[model samples]
Target: MVNANKVETEDEYIHVRFRDPDQFDEIRTPEWAEDPAHSVSEGSEVRMGQEEGSDDWQVESVLIKKNVGEDKAKDQAEEIVEKIES
Candidate 1:
């Protein structure tokens, strides 16, 4: 889940909910994601991964679908979360 309000602050960062099978974690928007034109909203589904031997996960892309509804975006996020947890 993304915290909608947090993105509006001066920091221009959003809070993302992350799960690691047995636990839930929180991640903030990275510097690469600070561009207003490409910034992700509360329901956006983003792809994230870390480089080999690196501990930090970086946002790779934000998935966008034409005419998709907010509910659908949320569903997508949930599905990704489920896969990660599984």
Candidate 2:
């Protein structure tokens, strides 16, 4: 039930519109709209990591569902880090 569309990109930031009715109702600016590196939820984290031997970095973000346990966000971070490292 989660989806996203890239709206725009700049040298310093990228704008993405996320679709999650369970979390939002309409196409609206996120609470952390000002910072592409900010997450809507405290548990989640958004960041850009430089790729190996490349100047460009990859945009990554993850959110833990409410049904999940409290440490779900940290678990998500670990998974993302593992994927990026591999």
Q: What is the C-alpha lDDT of each candidate?
A: 0.38, 0.37
Clashing pairs in 1: none
Q: How would you encode candidate 1's per-residue C-alpha lDDT over 1-86 as one tens digit per residue?
A: 33211111112322233323122133343444333223333334455555556676644334334344445444444444443334
Error of 1 at 69 (Å): 0.8
Query: Against the hidden reference, what TM-scores do the models get?
Result: 0.31, 0.29
| Model 1 weakest lDDT span, ten residues long | 2-11
Alpha-carbon runs more than 4 Å astray in model 2: 1-54, 58-61
RMSD of each: 9.6, 15.4
Backbone clashes counted, model 1? 0
The digit string of per-residue lDDT tens for model 2 on 1-86 reads: 22333233333333332322333222222344223223333333344434445554343334434444435444444454344434
Note the clash tally of each candidate: 0, 0
Error of 1 at 75 (Å): 1.2
Quality of model 1 by C-alpha lDDT: 0.38
Q: Highest TM-score: give the candidate number.
A: 1
